[model samples]
Target: MTQRKRMMRVPAFPNNAKLFALAVVLALFLAPAPARADVTKTNVGGTDLQANVQLVEYETSCRTTESDSDLIQGIIMPRNPASVRSVYFYFPGNTSEDAAVHEGGSDPERVCNPNTDGKTQFCKIVNNNQQFAVVTFNRNDAHTNTDNWLDEASDIQCFLREARTKIQAYNMNPSELFVSGHSGGGKQVAWAVANGGVGFSKTIFWDACYGTQCSSTAPRDNAGQMYLYYRAGTDTQADAEKAKQENSLKTKLVETTLRHPAIPNGCFLDPSNNDLCGGRGEEKGELVVGTVEPPFPLGLVFDETQLIIQQPQPRITIPGLQFSDPEELRQLIVREPDGSVYIQIPFLGQYLAAVYQWAVAAAGIIAVLVLIFSGVQWMMPGNVITNILTKAGGERQEESQNKAKKRIAGALIGLVLAVGSYVILYSINPDLVEFKSLRIPYIIPKPLVETDEPVDSIPFSALPAGAPDPALLPTAADVCFPLTRDSLDPRRGISWNWGSHRDGSDSDACEADSDRCHAGIDIYSKFPGQVVAVADGIVKDIRHVSRCADGWGAEGAERPGDGIVIYHRSLGLTFNYAEVDEGTSRVQEGQEVRKGDILGVASYCGMLHFEVYQGEVDRFQTLNWCPPGGIDVTERHQCATQNYPRPDALANPNDVVRRLEGNFCR
Candidate 1:
């Protein structure tokens, strides 16, 4: 472990600070390498993105012993002083390297920290002495003997401790931390959000969903702190469609913030049928924000400075785009790749067998007690053993029977207690639960799934020719939102996106994009107060989105997918959230908002939908917060916000607004 600890540290010259400075100087003064850590640097940026960039690294203990100089790595990307009121951590995708990691089983060897080996991964730290910090440590565990490859959430917690230690020495506030991740990395974010402890408040998901990693028993985040996103697009027929899906997701999540739900902002997904997440990648930026128009933020630019320091992009001829569609571009050739499926088979079987054996052992113990009872009962003729009991006087035979019965009862009680103790112990420590669900039942040893039958069971058999044709789809619990005004709780307003399939409301019930009816509604102040407090007093803890609709317009709506939140005094009351078809905006803390005031419009899956919190909080059984009729619950739909546009790009802000006026579903 000690040796592993040393491996986790970032490598440096004689002086850590000076060496880092020198490394920065080298990158600033020279060319970037094609790869990293064969020395301690990464080639950052590409033809795709650019921005102010810096790469910093941090680590934790490896499992290897102290004496050995060998070890594995831990990675990090932190926002120096946080910004955008949140943070994101992208997870590495499934690749040849991951395939190799899996091939090694659960015990994938931990590598030396990249910084130590002279390799670099980019880390962005803001120079401000801000009070909050966003740490992104996506667990890179691919191999190991553990049940699940544990992401370093606990380790990250420990790292936060270290950060706090630094803060104490430097006399800074212990800042709040938020975590975000994509793909499998999203799973790590989910775990951290649920268990990341106090410093961590919410999560951002990219190209992922709860799936099984999010346990059913797990509590749902009600404050709207938890957000999920997925995006996909089409081909020549639909280059713009990709942008819509991404916009839609961001819109939905952003909208959720109004109701003060746990989710902060929906994910930004430029829809593409590409693969997995449909080509959501950029070499840079906190949010890959840019106007489809002009004066794009520098954050939109991909920083190549790091690359210039190492391997400069070669003038090598690149292959032409071969994909016919976004979907085609994303196809992966999935080979078993020398890795095991049902990898925990052996271990799981042992656990089951152990459990069964233990049960049988208990049964045997019960049987022994029964035998003793039987022997006592059978000693009817006053055998010496029996007489010893009946001795003094003519002890009643019935008394002997009663005595035997009591003994049996006592034995059963003891057995029950013993078993109970074992259960308690197992609960406290999972090591005691010796059972595993490693393999699917009837899994073929050298297995394969038959494709002849067609995997989608019903497939999209009777579908329209070009689009998804609305033919297929199958697919949370503890969740909340914001109330911006003194008007009635927005949550009591219209429920967005509660389509016929998922929430059981018909699509017709949803206002069409062409329809001017604000799809979501505004819950008016029941008592008409300027500052209507949420039903509860804890409203202070919530995080909220602060964008005006006019500023958001279509592009912001399509891009950010971000939302905001405000806590309530009551447990269940909430406001309405309707995503805008606009651009993302910046919001500051403690800004005063009015009752029935427009918070920010959300950019949800192509519509302005709203969810409500009127009934019980069961994940499956509640109604949406959308108000009656097609009226936007915001009371007056266009009353609250103005749209904001990205500075650069060819788009005319006026045109975007004009299109959104009609297209704005909310």
Candidate 2:
């Protein structure tokens, strides 16, 4: 070994070279290997796609149990991180079990691999369109209760933040962001846009939007493009139409013949095909889709029609020039190359009006200031210092005094003119001082008073041929009583008589011109109970009348409460069921009801101010005369015009009461 070493040691290696060799050997043996990215083979509509999936964890309060940690998992498939152009977040529909324990286990492969035909289309669309997809899992327990995604808006925001971070880790800087949901997931998508503030330019709802959130302008204003997809004839369709009506500029309703669960399959299979997935799929409404400039120039084009400004053109009037319509004004404002007018400033009239007002106010202020200065000069004719400086007295001082007197008189005249002009203009017409164009007052002609035409009252003969037997309970023949017999017992202080008013005043006598006469009968109960509809009718109106304070039917202690008015088209009469609890109203305006249907619970005041009108009369005619009852000035005015005991159509309800008491045979 000594001989071999001597032979090889002809040259010596440097210290640096020896160190480099040793480091290489150590690194090869001790260094850890690079980790492999998670890759999954997703079968999307018969096509196997290889995608780099990541399991991202985020903090959220949306959980099945309070003891459960805030941690939640989301699935992200960044097909090609370097080439990602957009990020599409998908919220799956409600599950029968907690999303983590569903059929696909915690892996969420049902949404990732997209086990369903409809879900597979989403994956395929994302994979083929250079778009990264993210799927969020919800903590819904079928056996317990399904949670609303809208209720946990904060959770949605947290998930989005974490998902974006995960995408960035793959070196993706997507220029566009998108959100989509199915069924309950649709609510999630809406909440994200409404409250998440995640800068999603495009949003889609699939068979969702059954609530008022989508109909709101906030989401539509936030998203650059919004598509509401619904199965034909579903509530979702109706809501989508409402959203379209509210935000016609941004919202586009896409109706499909496919079932709710299968909508994604049909719509996502080809998003660009208007006849297949777009609004034209079912050909229900007009859906205009074309390229247009975005609100801001970001070098990106959108697949939406240009916003057509439908604002009415401003009215322009000039002393010398008269323009017939807005087109003529536009032609006058903008000039052609040959010097003909062409362009228009829509706000010209408003601008000029504002300027005129400012000028008038400024002139008025200057006149008052001049008047004050003149008054001060006239009171202090000449001070000692002024006399010494002028070195004049007697005749000269008198001349100066006279000059000041003249100036004061002139200033007074100017002030009077300025102040009087405003007063005169205001007296002539309040609108003149308002600086607005004069408008002819529209006067509603007074109706002719007919002395011979008598008010129609429900006759006693109108009741079934028998006396009201209190012993007999209301039957099917009676349809329904205003108050159940149990709640209308005589011992409970309620009676079949109609003489006293709700205010405990006599309501028997009526004067033609008196507005204080009671227009309805007051029925009181000892305890609050169900108030049923007496006859099948359509609800005409509802009102908040008075609330209970110290106790039921207490004097001078009631608050604002609720009432309902129903129009019995068959009977050609309106039934005013007043003083019901607002929180308990079971019917809405225009809703049709059958006899015996519970209208609502009586107020805690235990009073039902029941009125029967001979014909269809809304709250204006029926409730206006009552204090603290009219909703608007028009209704209040009607109270003065149509005095109480409404002479034209008021009816006595004794016969009606008999019929409601089961006295009617048919």
Candidate 3:
């Protein structure tokens, strides 16, 4: 108030206008500075090249809530900026970024030297190229050693866009942008071309396609984008072939006998030199393209004597036992009883069971605490004389006593209900309350033996004395046996007859009137084998059928079992292979399968229920046709109108079984 401090009031403006002015001022102060480039002389390969090194901070789509900025150290080397027609963006692989630039190495006074004094394989190729500007970025700033490209895809796209602009500032306007990466970097290039929303002219994979990278949908999605898939003769060769087959026109597969690490450099160098490049024999570095006459024969045969050097074998350590093969580890983890292993409950079941156990324990503790609280209330002091003198106090005391009694009664009731329910469940079935892991036996599929001779070429002398003539009998051309020849023996394998009740139904009639009539022949095996496809067909449907109490034994009652339905388009027939082992299906719905391809192993009960239909009848559609408990009168009936086994599509599988038996039963 001391003379009002000679107050000078600033002019007031509208709120929106003030906000706009504030935003402008803040933006000016907080906005990122323009990327500064330091030009320096760097020796690459054998030539002295001018390199423009820049540290760029770019806004990335790594987070959705707010803008996030990331920094990358990039080096651009151009022989002639004016003559540049394309820009190659190279994303260095994990840990390889160190080879490009080191800390404190980007100063104007320092020379940008390659890690090996410009003698590295990659440097050799970089110095050879003159028409394109090679821009290499260190992604280690944003993503350290992580190989997943999806995490930094947005950041990469942002950097590329900014890089193009920076290159243009140097008086170079490149029309085409190419991306290439080695190993982990290759994964990045693949993702960028596939889903980065950037228009990359070409992508080069330097043995980068590994694991799911080979199965990437990028080739299919980017049909027009050109891809050069380089494979080092290793695990990735098979995967690379899959990607090339997706789009043969735009994709090329190149194979080299080099190992995974040496592929990037060896691919460009001539294969004739045995020193700098490893000993290049014939077909060492074969370039296979789509136009090549015969596709490059995959699975190259290498001279083991020349290649595989004898080394000291590492001793595998198992806590309690020693195993020569890794497959033996299964014996320790998986619980196998009587040559049968159990199929584990799904993840959801395990999670729910854990939650249920926790809930039960919590409920019991809460009930006990409630009882304790009630006991404390009962122990609280109350004077009889004082209560009687005051009527209101007496009534209050009475209410307190009643509340304690009610709480005690409620706690007791809760405990009884919890314990009684568990007891009842236990009495009904011990497994319901045992809380032990569910052990549903998983039938292991018998291994298929490969042989040079075909089944048709089998000598007649191999057949049993009473066996039918091999030539006269129906061959696998008609239908391959579901089980192997060894699995068709009555003693060692399976045994079944047509029109026999698997549920042990006493009814002699195989008519629809008898609900207990067996719909198909049941092939019972003491030890089951893999179930094979009956004919060449497409898998139409996969089903899960719950076992009825009357069938088999009560042990598997209400348990769901797997079933497969395959439709032979050429034959116009549908084959239903039921009671397959749960979780052991080798074929999927809509997958094409040839005759003798494994469908799955037999069921836990060592049985296969085989059925046939005249046309394309889905197994699921026939579920309602004469279903257990009968069809509802309120709904219209299609195949259930007649009686039990009512579907007219149903065809006796006896004839087919008899023909297959001749081939396998010997």
Top candidate by lDDT: 2
Clashing residue pairs, candidate 3?
Answer: 512-644
- lDDT per prediction? 0.30, 0.51, 0.48
Per-residue lDDT of model 2, residues 1-666, tens digit only: 674454244323222333433343344335455534433444533645546433333444333232153244454555566776666677666666544433222224445444445333444455555555555554433334445343554455556655665666667877767787777767667767665544456677767777775676222333546677787777777778887654343456776767666665466533334545744366443433232122222111111111221233446443333223432221112111111112233333545555554555555555445544444443444666436534755446445545655664565566456546768998998768653322222222223322222223333444322222333323346457787543442333333323222331222232222334345555654332457788788898887766676434343455555778897765667788877766668889889998767777664566676777767766624433342332222321232233322334555555566556632111
- Candidate 2 Cα deviation (angstroms), residue 168: 1.1
The RMSD of every model to the true structure, in order and in angstroms, is: 28.3, 29.4, 27.1
Off by over 4 Å in 3: 1-34, 37-70, 96-124, 141-153, 173-176, 221-233, 257-261, 268-666
* Ordering by TM-score: 2, 3, 1
- Identify the candidate with maximal TM-score: 2
What lDDT tens digits, residue by residue, belong to model 1 across residues 388-458?
77675568655775575566556555545544565787889966755533432222132233221211211
Alpha-carbon runs more than 4 Å astray in model 1: 1-177, 187-413, 416-666
Predicted candidate 3 versus true structure: per-residue lDDT over 347-465, tens digit per residue:
23434455555555555666666655554444442445324533655456546656766876676667567557867998999768653433444444443422221111112243223
Ten consecutive residues with minimal summed lDDT in candidate 1? 328-337
Model 2: colliding residue pairs:
334-341, 334-342, 334-343, 335-342, 545-561, 546-561, 547-559, 547-560
Which of candidates 2 and 3 reaches a greater lDDT? 2
- Candidate 2: what lDDT? 0.51
